[model samples]
Target: MRRRFGQSLRVGVAPGALALLKTSRWGGAAPELVGELAFEGGSHPEAIGVALRQLLQGGGCANWPVSIVLADELVRIWQVAPPAGSARLADLEAAAALRFQTLFGEPTGAWKLSAGWDPAQPFLAAALPRNLLALIEQVCAAQRAPIVELVPQFVAGFNQWRAALKAGAWYGLVQQRVLTLGMIDGGAIRAVRATALPEGADLDWLAAHVAREALRLNLAAPARVAVSGHAPAAWSKGATHAPLACHLLGQGQGAGWSDCARLAATGSRP
Candidate 1:
C-alpha cells in the first residue's frame, strides 16, 4: 500500500490487548489502519512482546515511528514531595523512590522510574515494569521503529488538555473501566488516584466516589471534575444531588504528536 499519511503509528497497551492505529497524521490524509490483539492474562513482558510483534506485522507498520500509551492499569503513578531544601536531581530521585516504596511496598530496582522531577515541589512520578519496558524496546529495535513517546494514559491526558480545565475543577481520565483523577489546587497537584470502575457506574457513582476520595484525603471535592477520555456522554446530561459536576473536556491545544507528549522518546538506539 502506498503511504498516504505520514507513517506515524499510535499504540495503546493494556493488560489484555495491544491496539495499533496508523493515524492520518501530520495533517495528511491516509487509509486508516487499526488493529488489535486480545489475549488472556496480564501484560507480561514476553506476552506483550509477542502481541506487539503480531500487531505490527499484521498492520505492516514496521519501520514506522511510534508513540505509545501504557494503560493506567500497567503503570503506578503517584505524587512525591522533595525533602525540605532539596536541590539536586539525586534528591528528587531518592524522594520518588522512597515514596514509591512506601506506597507500593516494593523496592524500585525492578521498576523503571521516571517523573517530572523538581527539587522545589511535589510532582507526579511513574513506574513501568523493567522487563516490560525492555521488551518494548527490543521490539521497537527489531522493527527499526523509533519510539517517539511512551506515557501513561493519565499523564498523557493531563499533559494535553490541562489548559482547557476550569479553574479549581479536578481533572480526570476515564478509559477502559479505569478512572484516574488529579486533585489540583493553585497550579500544584495535591493528589492522584486511579481506581477501578464498577459495571454500569454513572454520574452518581462518580460523584459519590469523588466525594469519598476527598473525604479520605481531607480535600473539598471540587464543584466540577473535568474529564478527558472515553467517559460516557450520558454523564453530561443529568442532574442529581451529586456533590460534584462532570463535563467532558474539549479538544486540546495539542496538534499532531502532542497528543502523547508526556514522556520523552527513549533516546536514539543503535
Candidate 2:
C-alpha cells in the first residue's frame, strides 16, 4: 500500500550564517508556520535561525509539500520490516519534520505543517465515493492546466475501470505492459506503442523499437516524445533517437521518500 501527503517547505540553514528555502511538491498556496529545530550545531543553529528570520523578512517564498495518499497494504509491510538503522517509524517522522525546519535556518518550531490523508484510496474506483468523485470531477473540469495524466500502476483488471471516463474525453490504450494515452482534449499523445528490448539491447536496437512504435501508432511527429525507464541512457546523445525527447524513468518525485506527513496521515509511519 502507498500513502500520500503534501509538502509545505524544506529549509536548509548554514552554520550560524545563511539559510536557504527549497520548494517541495503539490503546487498550491502554502501557509506560514514557525517550525521547531532539531539540531546539534554549537553556535550554528542559533546563527542559522537569525539568518532565516531575516531572509523571510526580506520577502521570500515558503516551500509547499506535495500530498500523496498511501495504500493500506503498504503500511502493514513497513510496520513489520526492521527499522532502518535502528530508527523506528516515529523517529523518522520527527526527523523529517525537523529537517525541514533546520534546512530553512529557522529556530526550533519554524517549519511544521499539518499533514492530511484520506482513509480510502482516492485513485481506486470502488473506494471513491460518489460525493468525493463529484467534488473532484467539478474541480478537474475547471482546471486550465490543459492536461493532467494519471498513469496508475498497471494492475490486473485495470481496463474495466476506464469506462467511467466521460465522452469526448481522452482515450485509454493498453499496449503490452504499458498504458499510453492523452490526458486532455487539446493535447494528443500522437501514439501509444510498446516494444520489448532484451536486457542487453543496445541504443540502435532501442531506437528501432521507438521508430517502429511511432509508425505503428500513426502518431504525427510529436512535438516531443519523452522516453523514460532504465534504458533511455543507453541511447547516444546525438543518436537517431535524438529527434525525440528521451528520459529515464517518468518525471516526478524520487523513489524513496522518508516523508512522515504521508505516513502520519495514513497511520503508517515506518
Candidate 3:
C-alpha cells in the first residue's frame, strides 16, 4: 500500500521561549517546513500558555501530530547498563525509577519516563515532567493536535551529528543555561556531564569548566570539539589544553534550538 504523507508539528521549548514549525513530505521527497509559528515567550507558565494558545489558534495546525523538543536542562538523562536477562518495559521502568530516585530523591509521580538500549551500548533513559507535558498536550488537543513524541534537545542535536561522533572524541554543546560535555568511543557515549551556566558567563569561565571536566573525566586532550547554541568565539581558538579543531552547528558559529526541534520531530534518535 502506498503511504500517505501527513503533516507534523514540531515544538521547541526552552526557558522563556517556544518555537513551532510544521513539516511534511510528499511522495518520496524530503520533508520540508510548510508553516511556522512566531517565537513566543513569557516569564511564567500561564503567560507562556496564553502565548502558545494564541500561536496555535493562528497557525491553523489542526489534526496534526505534535513533537516536543525540550531544553536540555528540563530533561534528565542517564546512561546505565541494560537490565539483566530478558526484561520487559515495565522492568526497565522500575529500574529507571530507582535510578531517578537515587539521583533526585522521592518520586513525584509527575514525570514521564523512557529507556532504550542499543546493542553493545549502555542503556539510555530520559524523563520529562508530566505536568508540563500535559499542559502542552492540553493546549494542542484543544486545537485538534495530538502529540506523538517528546525528546531532549541534546539527544536530538546529537542525532544530527551522530556520524561525526567518532571514537576518542570529545564534544561540548551549549544551549540556554546548559553546557553539556561528553566523550564518544566507537560511536557509543562513554561519559557525559551537563552543567548549568550562570547568566553572563564569559568564555574564560566556559573554557575553564571544560578543562576541569576533562580532567575529572580523565579524558585526554581532545583532537576535536563540536559546539552548538551560542558557543563563544574563543571555542575555535584552541581554548583547551590541546590545539583542537572545532565544528560548529549550522552555517554560523552556533546552532539554534529550533534545529534540534526539527530533528527531534523528523529523525529517530530518542
- Return the top candidate by TM-score: 1
Who is ahead in TM-score, 1 or 2? 1
Q: Is candidate 2 or candidate 3 better by lDDT?
A: 3
Stretches of candidate 3 exceeding 4 Å from the true structure: 1-8, 22-48, 83-88, 118-120, 196-211, 218-221, 237-243, 253-270
Q: Residues 1-270, candidate 3, lDDT per residue (tens digit)?
A: 112366566777665566666555444433434333443343344555666677667766677677777866666877655467635666666777887788878783878887664433566677887767777778888988787877877776666666766555666666645677766555666666788877665555655665676677665656666765555555555445344556655434213435434433324221
Candidate 2 structure lDDT: 0.30
Pick the lDDT winner. 1
Candidate 1 residue-wise lDDT, 130-197, digit = tens: 98888998888887778988887778778877777888889887665667889887677878988888
Candidate with the larger TM-score of 1 and 3: 1
lDDT for each residue of candidate 2 in 1-270, tens digit (9 for 90 to 100): 121254333232222222222222454433222232333442333433344344433433222222222221111100011224633445444544444344435433422222211222111111212332233223323421111221122211123223333433333222222323332223322222234446555545544555555466454333232332222345435434554433232222212322221121221111
Rank ordering of all candidates by lDDT, starting from the highest: 1, 3, 2
| Consecutive 10-residue window with the lowest summed lDDT within model 1 | 261-270
* Candidate RMSDs in order: 5.7, 19.1, 5.4
TM-score of candidate 3 against the unseen true structure: 0.71
